[model samples]
Target chain A: MTDENIANHLKSLKKYTPARIGVGRTGTRPLTKDFLSFRTDHAAAVDAVYGEVSSKLIEELDLFSVETCYETKDHYLKRPDKGRILSEEAKTIIKEKCTPNPQVQIVVSDGLSASAIDENILDVYPALLDSLSMYGLNIGTPFFVKGGRVACMDDIGEILAPEAFILLIGERPGLVCAHSLSAYMCYQPKKGMKESDRMVISNIHRSGTPAIEAAAHMGTLISKMLDQKKSGVGLVI
Target chain B: MYKKTTLLGITYEFHSLKEIMAKANEEKSGDELAGISAENMKERMAARAVLAETTLSDIRSYPVVAPEKDDVSKLIEENVNEEIYGVIKNWTVADLREYILNDEHLSKELLQIGTGLTSEMIAAVTKIMSNLDLIQAASKITVITHCQTKIGQKGVLASRAQPNHPSDHLAGIRASLFEALSYGIGDAVIGINPVIDTTDNIYALLNETKEVIDRFDIPTQNCVLSHISSQMRAIEKGAPADMIFQSLAGTQTGNESFGISISMLEEATSLIFEKGTAEGQNRWYFETGQGSELSADAHFDVDQLTLESRCYGLAKHFNPFIVNTVVGFIGPEYLYDSKQVIRAGLEDHFMGKIHGLPMGVDVCYTNHMSADQNDMDNLSTLLSTAGVNFVIGVPMADDCMLNYQSLSFHDIATLRNVLGVSAAPEFADWLKKQGLTISSGQLTKQAGDPSFFL
Candidate 1:
């Protein structure tokens, strides 16, 4: 290619997405730095998937803790079904300790990457609580679900009987970005609701959409979802 | 083409550019760029840029041909005739058929063009196309495998020393090639992975490689992989593109990440078919691996390993001369340790072989991977046991530019020693004649052997 052509290729504007392109290649392979960076990113991703959320974060949030059906980390990684429901003892604990029929139910889980919450929750959780309180939405007893998936919010909602449910969970980590989180919200969340029936504000982290900003947006979105009695694709932003 | 399908009760419609695209994501060959297909996209982009630049000035200057004025069949015939390559001059459809039927050593390129023949015309054709014929036509394409010295049979597992440099400087490339050649490796293609992937740089690199091969009289073809479009552009600018090289993904979405689509891939395939003449064989060289889907986020809930297997369908569709799987180059998120990396190599090879691909395992890992040379040794030995087509032969199998560790010339020698397989006959003979090999036809000297005594 000519120098002019090289300049043109370099000048092509890259999209502001966490996609691995525009990073030049050395011949057919990725450049050394790029390859090493990819490795670093990948190592973090694997660690995120396998790592655990800290109990200190849960205690700091002043939330009750419960367990999902998953018996272990390997079980959680391999089985999606187990991560979607409350354990027998955990269901009993939730029924006893948590209030029912609240306006909004806030739940947490290490869905795929614990570091997502371990790192970003301090910024997002308080901001979300402040926003919800400012909106005059009555909040239920907040709690954490260990070894949980996004669908666990439905089970929580069924038990707590909330008007709206917001599950702050870890998004599946990719090599591009690992410390990303999501808030999957649903109006009257219950068992058997399809994935599309839920709405999510994803890519919540410092580098992506700021956790505080996402939490503030989630408050408005949840309020709107409760008013419309819907919270998915049908809800217009 | 449009495909209407339901995945997980969600109905979706996608614009399918190839029949393969309609079937893609359903079973196999899903990703778009599985080879020089990336180049096809780049060329299309380049062409689009030119078209956009001239639109205001040239749009009204050109006369629009009336669709009704052209005969549909005649247009189809003309287009197909123009694309068909490797046939003798002035040969009619019948004449071409006769020529192909009469020649026992017809190039795979010529035979592939036979697929476009009309039904009535095909009926007149006597030679039936088969996979066995494709295997036999291996030496017809301009690939390294098609080098005068045949890809040695009897489970020899043709080898190539792929010395990837930080910069594809001619000297670094030559140093790697010569050192490997000194060890009797790289009877296959002397392919280089350049740091700069552009038409001019790659062309210069390829020309330098050609000079080395010509000067040393090496019995191998030179492959400079600069994406397919740039390679085609370089070739047009007088670059030696002995074999077309491209990286491919398993899913169309993954291929698109590399800036390629099925139609674009087909376009590049046809361009290579038309622009270059092979020594009678398959000319395309493909590189694929696991984790592309995961990296590109196109795995569609499938595991990276399974998705990698599906990618072979893309290589098989094109009839590639060499399909090298860079086993652990993507790093730990996909394949964490040496065990995982080794298993991935074995799985990719088996999957490629099942799809009738000429599989070559680049038993390699990235620097961040918790893998070592011993892991490559184990995996490549296992691959050799399964009769893989080839293994990469770099100086030490550690690519300076790419920052990945792979099998070295010494590793290839080890495989030969342990597995009892030899290099291509011509390369092995050359090694023996040059006193690099002992009488046992291996690189290593026996304990009591005095073939290299002072």
Candidate 2:
């Protein structure tokens, strides 16, 4: 193959995958542009993990805030179990503020990549609300949990005791999409719930699973869970 | 039996051998997270001091997890050459370290000595080793393995061209594989980690990668890394697989969490021998990491390093074609930063080599970890200099599928050139024929162009 032919073929192949192929190299090393671009994407991903969900967005979503037992980003990364339960004050506040035994309880968390919440909540939250309304589900008071993990839904679930629950949480950032979010849904979530009892729709972002589509899909899943009185592996989709 | 030591005028006393082993480890976040690491630097040094004085027999007498309780411990205990163990039964951990680093000992003598050692003994010596000590000791040993082609010979640096796609698109896998082949990579194996772990998915991936190898007439093997059961099903149904792959854990409970067991592995081995394409005696590929047992809640109160070494003991029993520690993928709770990751990578390589396995390293890091491509570059180069068997090569270090960074195809090619090494002999010859590389394994003008295959 000639040089130009190879370049065109490489360009054409790039559409088939997200892998960083076809970027020309310089003597068994990446060219400076491609190298720097990769580093930049990695930097963005790292920053996304360290970034925080802004308060303005939380207020805009009309969600009150609570915190997990983990107080700092470092602690959150080091002790995942700490992120799985509510703080003492958070537990008290949640009990005081939340509506108990609702049909659907929606929660948000900056699980691993806070930027996932920062970038995605606006589109996904509103779409989810509309979709739930379409399903005619009784929505409970929504709130946010800081420095939280996916299992923190169980803590909120214990307090609210919703018939069905959905926690829109941040996924661990990847170079391809740092702002991707995941929606984990469970039926009658409680402490000591088996992980297999929860279902998830992951990679919600502009590029992957579009926010609105994922929200709509999640809404449909919630209805199925309610219908079957189950979620996760038990639910027949 | 003595578990107390004073270093720099600070006294430290560990409650048990497990505590001593965990504290002696160079700062790892996982031990800290488990609430088992030494309380301070002086205490850590004190633990190392006590550990170095501890004898091999002492460690053997007190298995971290007893043989009756865990099959992994039983298997490791069962594999020990009784005659060889008797010879070294009284050697202190410090004596073992000096013996390994001594200039007189070469690959043959060291590997023979390794038969006497248990995984715990190996982990003990590793805890006291410096970075350079780990590198030098490992460099003296060579572990050659063969599947379709020979790998891990002296002056030969192999690379596994991991052409993984997020959705397991065959065309996309081929595209990245072409890029790897163009750089004279994939001498190790054209392995793909399929997104979907079903039999059909693994079967298609295995067939597709095999087709690429056959079409190109490349001296390489093809594998699809799904669950062992999925691979077994695919191979049983006549997928053209070169080897079976599984992620290993160090304990019975940990292995169960991965849904694998000794009997299952034995069954998979038999099936591969009957139905696999590889003609060599070695045909199983196993990957492990530092904190998988802990992640599965099955560490048995053992430190990650000790548990990691035990995985090698189990791997050695299978006589695998290749074994690699997927270093840095377990996240910050285990490794924390580049320093800990680098330390674990070196320690894993040395320990596996000492246990007589064909060891490689997936010199990689996730985004959440406090590491970057520079760390991978450093570790990969360090492992290469230590004569590591192979390093995983993704396209531009970006695995969009597995969602981590590793040594890129370009990086592997550079390591080979900079270290004055070549690919496996058979694959190097093929690279020369394809005009991708010259006789010396240096990239030709035809290199870096995946369209060469097109």
Candidate 3:
């Protein structure tokens, strides 16, 4: 047969025809169904983990002062930029409720993916603080950054000017669970500083990374960053 | 609960213009009589002396002191001498020169001012001059760059031809092209050469380009064209090009080398010849597998490995056909970085492989280099040497597509068009044909039995 005739015949075939290829929709009825399922599963998982870690923190570490507590969706898809800046109410609450100039400030916020912070932050935060305390590093008032991007840490650093600022935020949501939080630490972060300049410990979640371990590592990284007066790729240790 | 914390900070102030000018006038008086333009020089010298004196007075008045970190101080710093007086004397003259040369409008208000010119007028003149310069420069130049592979005894030796890492190179090239085009470079063509073997590197290069687009600003509708070889095409298709082409051709000459079922080859040739012609300036994208051999001898055996080899051979043949009969040839060799592979395959005239092929490929390669320091320097040198015109690397890709990072398809298409490719319209039409179905947070392709190949 001629090339034209053959091409025509091949075009008639089902395989060659363009078709809807549903990517990232595996083992589910539809995308909406799969997404909902993922969200619910992640929320429950995060809640369970948080309950265990927070209880332990309260009982063993005597960590009772709660400045602010809030919840957001797992994917945080509805409010993507929410984590970047503190709300007016949140700012006011922080000013009134928490001590103004503690050696260090500790905050918890749902960042890129709320589920990440929900799943990882509790265990990570306490461990980080414990490590810092051991090093004789006094933390100032700590606050959570909800829906925070990496640059938000710079903003916080500007406001707090804590010898060093530690931000535990969720990494970008991936196919894996959304609750994978990352710890972004910087020494006096300011505007115009590139993201690479901020030190980060990503993948802090249950599946690939464990929270407590990541916290310990993050604490070490922060201490080194402070000691060297550098963060991100510039931090040697 | 959230609270507000007011962080204290300090700001610094600089000397005033009057003080600086006074100091300058004093300094210039000592050097007087050194110039031939006595009158004009005296005025200028006095101005300088006054500027210096003003600076001294301002410094004496303000004094330099380190501010306490937490202290509340005015954040605004005024450098009257540097910004106001210096700009008035230096920038105003520059603006007037530019205005006179370019014949651009000079504001009457600026002339009336005691100072040489107002800041607003200087800014306007500077903007106009810069834009004109950029336009003039862009119209006169076109750049060609490529990335390819060299086949080695062990494997493939990949290198990108640009000073920056492949991505940085792509970004820099795109930025330059966009700047040139925006400044009125008409029909600028950026040729790209890709080194195909492992998709990882190619995808990385594309991703780098994508990163450039994402991180920087570039004007739209700039021309960019890409020429990729068949082997590279096969890699993109995730299959061996020979088998795919054979299957598409409906060639039943099973397991025959160069046999290609004469009828199937003829039919394919006729179809391409009819659709792709020199008069119409039709653009054709060729696909093939990687190899350094080709033979018309029908007695050869055909297997997956051989099929892959033949794809490269097919590329050599198709390249000439496209270049001679069409607007351009998008050869993969230009993109491949492995010098040995390109040398063995194309540079050596497909040594021990295909012979008697037509010439004038008019192709550029794809480069994929990391943002790492070493790679950037190597890429810059390579691009400088190759004089590459265009490139095609991903700005982003879904996890399913080789690289987990995704790129903006719109930017890529626009870049290609800017590089002078007739294929851009067709590619854009194909994308639009996919329609508005969203899947996995991305547009889904439509299910249609459209007979385009026919």
Candidate 4:
């Protein structure tokens, strides 16, 4: 085949998949352009992990600030157990500021990618509020926990003891989408709950599941969890 | 068993055999996260020193997780060759390492002696081995298993075409698979990790890959890496599946976390043997990694390296057709960076090979880890030189579904060309027929064009 025919053939194949294909090679290795493009994508993902959620966004969302036991970015990355518990100061602050035992308690955190919250929360948060109100649910005071893990909801859950809990957190960044967010919900969340008891709606981003769509969907899931009095694998969606 | 050792005028003591084993391991963030890693460099060396003097009998008697509490330990214990064990039970762990590295011993003798050792013994020796020691010992053994075609033959490097689509789009999977075949990949298997785990989705993927195989008459098998239960249900409904796949863990509790058990595996094996399309005896595919046990909170105070070795022990019971360690996919906690991932890859490959399994390495990393494509390139080249049975091939080294990077189809083609290795013999013959590869195992100019199949 001629080079032109191969190019068209590659284009046709590339149309069907999102994978990096048909990038012409130089000998056995990838060409410089394709190589650098991949490197750039990787750099964005790494930056997302290291970046911090802006305090301005926290104030704009009308949320109080708290922290997990994670002391630094490196500590949070290495010691997941530490990230699962609230700091003593955070516990006291949460107790003073947040409502106790509401129908639904919502929390936000930077689980892995701060950019996920930076890019997505403005769209997801308002839609979630509107959806929860439409569902006629009593929403509790929402707060932000810096450097928190998915299970950190348990620590917050124990202090507040809500019937249902939702933790809007950043997902581990991938090359295709660095600013992806996830919503983890549990019914009667508490300390020492099984992972199977938590449900997640992941890949919420512009190109994947749109932030507003995922936010709207979470309200429905929370309603279902309340109706069934359970969550995770046992709850029918 | 010895529990205290003095090294460089510093004395160290361990509380138990498990602690000794944990501290002897190379530095891993997962072990440290569990609060079990050695405190300093001297302590690590001291633990290795104590471990080297421990005998095979000592390791066997003090199983990491006792046989009564864990079915994995029970299975491993029951499978030991008693006669061979009697012959080598008195050998020290250091003796075992030297025996493996000895030039006089060939693959057959090494494999025979491996039957006498348990997983703990394997982990013990692995901790004491250097990176080169791991590679040199693994390169000496060749484990060949067969399904629709053979894999792991000497001088034959294979690739598993992982044509995974983010949405399980049939056309997208086929397109990536075509790209892989153009580069003479997928001699091991055409496997896809479906986004949906329902039986219907697995059935459709199985049929799609089967159609591709039949249309081209490719000497390869097809698999959808769904849960084994889903695959079993698909096969029961008459899907054309060549092998069943599952992710294994070291402890029974860990397997439970994956929703699998030995009995369930046995049932799946029987169903495949009774209904599946594979023409060979070896028909199970398993993927394992370090830190899975700990991730499930089921490591039982054992180290990740030892838990990973026990996964091989479990895979050995089934005689899997292909077994690979997704070495770096677990993330930075288990293997912190390129350095740790590289060490774990070599260690996993060596341990799996010595257990007489068709071992492969999915030389890969996730975005959260401090690694890049260069690390993958280095590890893949090293593994190919180590005579790995196969490596995973994704389009352009990026997996949209799994959200990680692995070796690409071009990378496999380059490895085969550079190392003077060919694909499994039958697939190589088929590639020659398609004019994608020449007799010299170099890719032709017509290669890397999916339109060639069209």
Candidate 5:
């Protein structure tokens, strides 16, 4: 291809708008200060609500194995390669905190948006596990990833060899909501497995989707993946 | 209402609390007990008023500086002035917003700070109003970059001699991969050059990639390949390999280039599958075959491939194949109008059908507008509306360093909230729940936590 040819070829593709622009300025108003103050107050209120919910869930579910994992956003954002590898301490905790071997391994991560996990996991996780139990599958030791990515599944799969691996992680940060989460599942997940090798259940949140329904659906899909031995486009379901 | 009085107190020397209290008692206008309480309250109010006055004075000392576009040295100089005062009195917090909006130069400077107070507020507010849970769920998505090589027979050397270089094909691939990966999509299937030539060196390049495959342990079985020769050879054989492989390859590339022949690629895959079946081994198989040259009358017709055929062909080869196209650097003007190219390619190749694969647009970062939120949102929304899945480019240096290569969880949430779309939220939330974090300067873990989700 000539310079002209290459130039012409490039001339034909669509353009990309920055992700932030999709979220326009909130707007200017005489009550803008009041609105901002109110928002901050609401944030505090929500935090309190979620905190109470979390404690209740822990109590109601009889989950004595829960541990609080904390990390700074700065550390999580700078080291993606590090994100792919689990910390020794985390591994130790995982080994000690829950069952060792089971039919499947389920993990929850805060990913880039910790609020996502803090907000939705309490409801979604239990629903999913219940579905799994109904399918006669035993869940392995469940752990939390502080700053996770999709590739982290490979590391988790390598560390804990389960028949199926289900990872509920946060999505990339956007302008609108920071609490969304997705469940990615694969059979015998290993390093360098293309995304097509996995099945995803996405849009599981309160506003756009029902977390409970998504969990139940994810449960059904995982069972199907185990039975079919395929995912993505290959899985019949 | 009680009488109002203003008192100013300045001490030339420090006095003990007892002495101050005695003086306050001496000036009381009531009985001893009430006088003491009133004196204490007066002192307390006086202290608070003094502190507030000082703070206001300090803020007034420093002039508010506007943001710069290229050079931030001036803003820094002004910020230093503000710091010396221990408080910013003249500039209200609202002034910060004005500075960002009115002065592009200052905003660029602030971006250098990585995580400034303003950005943090923006990120936090954005996260709250947006439905982050949904963004995370849809995080794993596909981004396809569509392109078609200009019609002509040009050797690899000749193509390399041009400005884009090996970058032409690489650009398309990079854009598609970038878009897919940015959105947390793990796999990306790219379209091979439609006008395959005997002299092309891609085969050699693939051989080199073998090391990458082995080192990464990437499953090579899923990475399929198809060429004209492979298709033709499959057709000549009576085996069903020709139909399977030809159809698959055609479907994969049909969304990419109209010139791709799905039947040819499918035919080859079928032959290979049959060969594997005959051998009685469940081995990984990728079809290799050849295609008959088109007659003069049939040449144009042969070049046109349908979207359905392309999708089917790719589905046959790799179940969830990602179809991408190329958009070469035509010129600066083309930078602003890239959608025209994608529209034309879609019209020409798929006949305006939307494929399941993620579609994307790739361009040079040089042409990309710097630190323009409006531009970014416009571009993202346009692609999303057009059914484009992702965008690939050299994220702005500041953005990349800030680790904002793709949409941030906060940004994605904002998009969903504004557009009332669930996909963005689902995708973002899914990424976050996976514990995948994007920092400003690098892709790193958060503190002492493990990177993996186990």
Candidate 6:
């Protein structure tokens, strides 16, 4: 198809989503600009997977730190089970530093993409806290988790005993958006909880759902979860 | 570590694992020639002594293989014997799917013989399906043929090539190509997976691969996989990429887990169809499997096999040249067992062929998966009978880079020997003229011979 004709059809579909549809081609290949952009996006994703969350970010957030059993990225990739729990020292540290029985506990982790944390944690973290405080919600001591997966929240929940908890972690880096983050929320979440019992708000990136907007949405959702005493499948609105 | 040694002035750079194996294979091939005498041994030993300065220790890909067959009693879950008997005697895969389609109260666990089915299930189910149905399953896959030009002569077509290297350095790529030429080698295409996903990397690698094909007179088309869009860029820059490869899942959500969706696939397919070198031009090599739906949290109460069929539904629209299922790569968390894995492979083959898409089986498994070569052998024969178009031709039933075990050259030959089939028509004449009895010949020698590296 001609580039103009392809773009004409794609122009309509492109507005509906950030998907890679309607990407016009040159003869039998992607346009030079699209190809270079794909290269750029892929580079970001690789960087995200390999990059580490900065200590400055943690210090700025004033969040204490703990780590999952995953001591390396290789271990994290192959062993999902190992990535879901706190290390022995980490468990002790979290137990010592964290608040007990708070109405809501917020946690952050560089789950699969440290670049995700680098890009949006600044806006999302503070915005979430402000939104929760505005609702007169009492929050627990927020902490950062190193080498954490989404399920690590359950371990934190078990240690701290919160009514509702949210784990702001990085989603797996992809060529689409390397900095996409997800907020996994659950009510009274404990270890051995099924995945279906957790609720997630994903695609929290600049091009997707903006960080500031998602934080406002997350606070409202957490408030509703506390009101209903439920999350995931049982929680309504 | 790249050894700073020059072979005819080409700096040999490769991972130690790849280097050691390549040099060792070169040594073993020289040692295993025709006859041996004391003088010949002494001379060879003297040469080996000189060669030891640079050559690393031999590393066989399949150093040891487990004994065939696991005890079914220990593998199958308890309390499913009654359902097993019903699947074994009354309903075939199609019948069970009919029940699943009608929303009957059947166990969602009931799947392919390898993943969830027991040895007993394999025994009972194989009797019901027609040999032709098993055979016709692959016919749709191989019937669409592409001609290859070997310096203006017809080359091997409708075959899979051994394509994987750990570091994917030039030395590793060369070693893999040599391994691909060994006995029982021809399958479909030679596709290398570049460690670095870039236009320059893929463009250089595939262009070098074409030189290897011309130099060695290899018969198949070539593909260096980075990503479809990136490959398109390489092609636009004038690289010789035979086709594009991608892993497709059923739903929009499920496909996104692989960093792509159906719409993205549509854009790629439309682009590829418009550009190709072949007169018979069937491009876009797709791979799909069950369990991705569940793994991606998109199954939505749909059975894995049904979700897999929907993946084929997506591939069928583009008229894919080859669509394979990496059935066992997903591991036990999804398929659970050898029975489930095997049954899923067959189910996918059936569905792909039914969708009028060419289907191949990556009759493969990972170490973490609850399957062995014995189980893969069973599936290979069943798929061969059911007409699976081709399989991934890895060295010694293993891919060093992909980290998965697949049908070795020996397994392919053994299957073809029993089934009375050979390579596609393009290579059949060559196989005969060379007097290359692939199925009848022995690809596996006794222990101590250096294994080929790819």
Model 3, B1-454: lDDT tens digits are 1111121332212233322122222111111211211134344344333322232223223321111310101111121223334444433333443333442322232222212222222212222233233222222222111111011111111111111122324433443223222211211112223333244444444444334333432111111112222323323543211111231110122223333443444454444334321222122233232221111212112111222322323333232211111101111111123232222122211110111121111122211101121222233223212222222222111111121121112222232233332222222233334341222212232211122212
Better of 2 and 6 by DockQ: 2
TM-score of model 4 vs. true structure: 0.96
Question: What's the C-alpha lDDT at position B254 in model 5?
Answer: 25
Output the TM-score of candidate 6. Answer: 0.49
The worst-scoring run of ten residues by lDDT in candidate 4 chain B lies at B1-10
Better of 1 and 5 by TM-score: 1
**Candidate 6 chain B: worst-modelled 10 consecutive residues by lDDT:** B58-67
Isolated chain B TM-score per model: 0.65, 0.99, 0.23, 0.99, 0.30, 0.64
B442, model 2: CA deviation in Å? Answer: 1.2
Candidate 6: stretches off by over 4 Å: A1-154, A157-237, B1-142, B147-159, B261-263, B273-275, B432-454
Residues B61-105 of candidate 1 have per-residue lDDT tens digits of 221212133222222233334344323323343354335445553
Contacts from the true interface found in each model, as a fraction, amount to 0.00, 0.81, 0.01, 0.68, 0.00, 0.00
Worst 10 residues of 5 chain B by lDDT: B154-163
> What are the per-model DockQ values?
0.03, 0.81, 0.02, 0.67, 0.01, 0.01
Best by TM-score: 2
How do the residues A14-108 of candidate 6 rate in per-residue lDDT, one tens digit apiece?
A: 33333232333232234567556644655666578668999998998898888899887755654566778999999898778877999999999
Cα lDDT, model 4, residue A219:
94
Local distance difference test scores for all models? 0.63, 0.92, 0.33, 0.92, 0.36, 0.61
How does the DockQ of candidate 4 come out?
0.67
For candidate 3, give the lDDT of residue A131: 79
- Candidate 5 wrongly placed segments (more than 4 Å): A1-72, B1-454
DockQ for candidate 2, C-alpha atoms:
0.81
Q: Candidate 6: lDDT of B106?
A: 20
Candidate 5 per-residue lDDT, tens place, B294-336, comes to 1111111111122122222233223222232332222111222
